[model samples]
Target chain A: MTTKPWDLKQCIKNYSAKGIHGITIWRNVLEGQNLRDARTMLDDYNMEVVSVARGGFFPSVEEKKRQAAMDDNLWAINQAFLVRAPVLVLVCGADGRQPLEKSREQIKEGIIRILPEAKAAGVKLAIEPLHPMYAGDRSAINTLAQANQMAEEINSDFVGVAVDVYHLWWDNNLQQEILRCGKNGNLLAFHVCDWNVPTKDFLNDRGLMGDGCIDVPQIRGWVEDAGFSGYNEVEIFSHKYWATEQKEYLEKIKNAYLKFT
Target chain B: MTTKPWDLKQCIKNYSAKGIHGITIWRNVLEGQNLRDARTMLDDYNMEVVSVARGGFFPSVEEKKRQAAMDDNLWAINQAFLVRAPVLVLVCGADGRQPLEKSREQIKEGIIRILPEAKAAGVKLAIEPLHPMYAGDRSAINTLAQANQMAEEINSDFVGVAVDVYHLWWDNNLQQEILRCGKNGNLLAFHVCDWNVPTKDFLNDRGLMGDGCIDVPQIRGWVEDAGFSGYNEVEIFSHKYWATEQKEYLEKIKNAYLKFT
Candidate 1:
């Protein structure tokens, strides 16, 4: 298990040596590191890049700002290429400044704008459908079926969906969608996290894999059976884990993946 | 629109006079006034009780207490009858001290045990499927599909389901399930509440309809289209509402239901 105190280099090194596949990173981690420097860092550790942090939150009211959002997304796609990552995860933007239909249209238009850049950069953009809890301010794409609907409409090889267990565990159509995404070649990335029973805080109470009650293995089985063999990326948003030493958090992550994945 | 400190009498009185069809009660309100007295009070108010507070939490390893639980459920069913409520709402029991399968079997058995008593008392038992978040502790029946599965297994016209907006709002197949439940004549009660953004507390913090972002009228349209004609029973579980006077709460209920329902 990778320990929490480990930096990116140590994480990749340990993960690679242990036959653990790769790691997904947060945007802030790359804020100071230059794209070239980050690329070199991955090369030095002999680690694979599963995905870049993210690039989508498309909805915007001002037509002027919509261009800026698309420009930012282009930059993220370029960053994913720099890291040699195949996918740049995208969150469907919320209905913040306009009606839902207008926002949905905006999001669709924004995605179409980015598709050319994504294809040129050789990076597939993964449409990450957040739980409906985030439907108002986070993402309008709130279900796998909805995400797939957008993906089909776009009809691009560069666009797909990331199947995150934390956001999708409760979905009744999860298994069916997995098979559909798999058949349509829409399953771009796989992320794992547990849903705590009490789920104290909406944004921060995410559990470590196998620590909470979600049937993680069952979901993994469904994804695997559907032909998704990507990295089972761990992404817990636990305040408890955040408060602990990074080394311990990493160790728990490694152990949980081994146990639950 | 319902205000804080809800008044049982005024709510019933107004509902009855307006021909606003049904009433659903919480256990605290029922027990606070004593179940028997509450039933009598409701009868005097001329409101037809739609459903009882609840009868669930069946999964427990404490075999010695199983009979006690059954007896209490029997009492709840009798109360439902006394209040002239046709349905006794039930949440599938949680897994306590036993494996998930055992707990599921036990719940089925527990429901069977109470079915005779419920039938004898002329009360229909409505199985309410809670959100998957409550699968471990609150209720195991987490999906409308799952509730329908149980209803089929229970094989009784008296056993049905309560479609609570708070719990089923995020479901992808909700429209189909509502139609299916209605088709089978299994849609006994339709409870209404909003899913607050950044839901602060699972046990409380339900938003007043139209205060939150749920498409209430859309769902209401589905239920009605599927042949449901019951009252849009408002059941807010917010500490904020509980903090005010009962009269204010009743007024809010009336206003919110009028505007949102």
Candidate 2:
């Protein structure tokens, strides 16, 4: 949410100008915008369309709600195809009303249901295990080990895992798990962001690369060593950065990326 | 901090009156109080001293700060002894200025240094692995597995793990780790608090046992099955509850305990 002030067109134009070739478009950014035009805009700005920000809130206590989530996910897969993005990142969701194990099972069920369609649409699904803090309502998958377990179980070419430094940096088993994901050929994306000390807020308040406790360069080295030579997609959700001028924030992001990542 | 409205004497009286026989005292409550009198007061109220709330912030970037922490921990072991408590819950600390790995190493070192004092005082050191959110500054150890690993590596009967539901509720490997700790005779304490759905604040927004997503009775079952027959300690740190009438709040806590725990 760093460039909250900008629309998709402006974000593309400015990001490409600042030498950010990658763009992971959230579903909200695609709202009310024509998909064809959005694809054209990225091409016009010489930007590579990284994975679509999300698709997967697969668990709900209510049967109707779970069905509804499936419908929306199908639509999201189509969105990924329309934007010419190869992957749709999954924030595999949780249901606080039920046990976490139940929600986790539902996440696997949802992914398996979407696999054939995702393969047909020529879009891969990247399961992003969020930080444990988000496990309450955001995602049931809270560790790379858990994600690797699920991906290995599914064993689908269309399925993989996205490694986000902000979420997995604190994990002692991170390097080993990254190597496992890479060895399984399921490491699809790498997202960079920092966990600010005294993280004032749970959802927002993310720090830039070098501003927080995460050793981004060290984690990046691990990922690279594991054969992940993909784009380091910057996924930061910070109210602080969004309130600032987008152009200047982009400059800071570039500097942080170079210095840390 | 549900009983923030009460001092140590008042807390003992109220808790004992409410049939809360077991009490885990935070160091803050004993700040200016005489320790011998604190033990006498507990005796008068028929309160059982479960534990001294905390000691351990072992990691600091500065060497002087680390030395100071060791001194404080030595003092805290004395506090636990004076109060006739059997265990001291440790919130093993992390330094944002250094890598988490460095902080983790420092934590192990800190525990080793305090081992002799804790053993001499007849007090077991309980390593409370905090939630991953607290991994930024509060605790380098953020999982039961990590705590279990540390405890087993220490190979001392005096060093064990404190399982706090609020910190570990979301872990997929929680039950397995708890079993491992119990099997190794490293399970020292069981703390109960819930993770509110949104978890509005990082530090203070803890929920009472039955009020949130945590399945308290189920976890208690796991603990029991693993041969842990310790007091189910009620530790809730909530600004909202603390702001209310604690007498009535204690009633609510008792009710939640009976119904959930």
Candidate 3:
């Protein structure tokens, strides 16, 4: 993820100036800033915190690391509540040292441990299934179907799934999975970004809406059909974009969002 | 993918010298060489052509291009037959300009068009499902489940699925899909490689067996359990490996094969 130069306050100001209605708060952006102040800034800008930008690296081979991850997620839930973000997106982690099954089990256990806190805070924990490419170290959950299944198993109103076109666009079962999630009232968030053809970097080469092959509008249609009336969050992690003039890049994003997304 | 250095004869000699039992031939290596002579070379080295490296980029937006792809696959089938290779691995392609569904449809049609020739030539077509990262332009078939479904729908012995660890190791349904492929007698080939942790290149940063996170032996066990006793083909495309002294790399491959794979 390459967008690190802009701080939280700057991001909120830019988003509001660009007519962007919502923002997802990455945890790093909250560092050194008071949560209450961040909330105040969001209110001043009339910007909505669609979801807190991540709260799960649950899988770890080490017992201490797993406990620490759980503790960190609890902290994230509290942050999400303070920021007035209704959903906390989770990139459930994977441990390369252990079997994926074991890592998945740990993820389940971690979520269970944090679900109570999430519910108490009225901040839904949205399990965001990452792309299969990240399955080695990023996330064990790599499919909407898997996320949907997990959410259903967890069976709480506070637990749900975030449907991201960037991660899930390639899946043939995406529509069916979206429908399934929506049927179960598990669709919590929707993130949009395109998959670049010659995706240079696995983590930061995401395309703007119209720059790549992904049919974002079609996937958005599916999401909307599945009753997701939330923000079509533009979540690009592009090194190229980050290197450009931020204001000009913001204009391009707005144009792409209006014309393509 | 890396490894563009050696010719077919050199590859065979080097592999045989390193005591590598199998080699999958890329189609480019067959150019300007007599197929009969290639077969003779294989016999001389006492090495097996595991599967012809590729033969399907069937999806294209243009009708002529699609036809050309089908023709190319037919040629690949003949090459596989000439080399005494039983299978031709297909990277069924996707067109970024079109919907994945359209690309997939074209792939199915292309396979049906070529199936009769494959059967006549006694060359099985192995539909190797690529990683989802490649779904935009390389192959719409990104899951082993999709490959298995396609193989079953085809319902011919000439058509089967190639299970590659690099593409499919992350899949939650991998074991079950392997079982399904095995039960249908459609498991044509097994390719082995590891997903590098910080995989530098999406196309070529493949790790050696023990160098990365994949539990190669465990996946091998699954393949074996599913009745696949074929060559555990060491198919890696690594920039790092290719940059090294290939002989030393070959030795590393042998060691990894014996120890981890």
In order, how many clashes per candidate? 13, 2, 0
**Which residue pairs collide in model 3, if any?**
none
Global local distance difference test of model 2: 0.92
Question: Which regions of candidate 3 are displaced past 4 Å?
Answer: A1-4, B1-4
Q: Pick the candidate with the highest TM-score.
A: 2
| Model 3 agreement with the true structure over A58-117: per-residue lDDT tens digits | 988788998899889999999999999999999999988888889888888889999889
Q: Retained native contacts per candidate, as fractions?
A: 0.20, 0.94, 0.74
Q: Score the docking of each candidate (DockQ).
A: 0.28, 0.90, 0.79
lDDT: worst 10-residue window of model 2 chain A: A1-10
Q: Please write out the lDDT profile of model 1 over residues A1-261, one tens digit for every residue.
A: 113345566777767666666877655567777878777878877778888877887887677777788889988988888888888999777753344556667788889998998899999989998976676677877778888898989999999899998888766678999999989899999888887766788788888887676778888998898898888888777777878877556677788888987
How much DockQ does model 2 earn? 0.90
DockQ measured for candidate 1:
0.28
Write out the backbone clash pairs for model 2: B1-B236, B1-B237
- Tens digits of per-residue lDDT for model 3, B215-253: 888889999999998898888898788988877777888
**Best prediction by lDDT:** 2
Which 10-residue span in candidate 1 chain A carries the lowest summed lDDT? A1-10
lDDT of 2 by residue, A1-261 (tens): 458788999999999898788888888999999999998989888889888978999999999989998999999999999998999999999989899899999999999998989999999999999999988799999999999999999999999999999899889999999999998899999999998987898888999998899999888889998998889988888999999888999999999888887
After superposition, candidate 1 runs with Cα above 4 Å error? A1-21, A60-68, A96-109, B1-22, B32-36, B60-69, B96-109
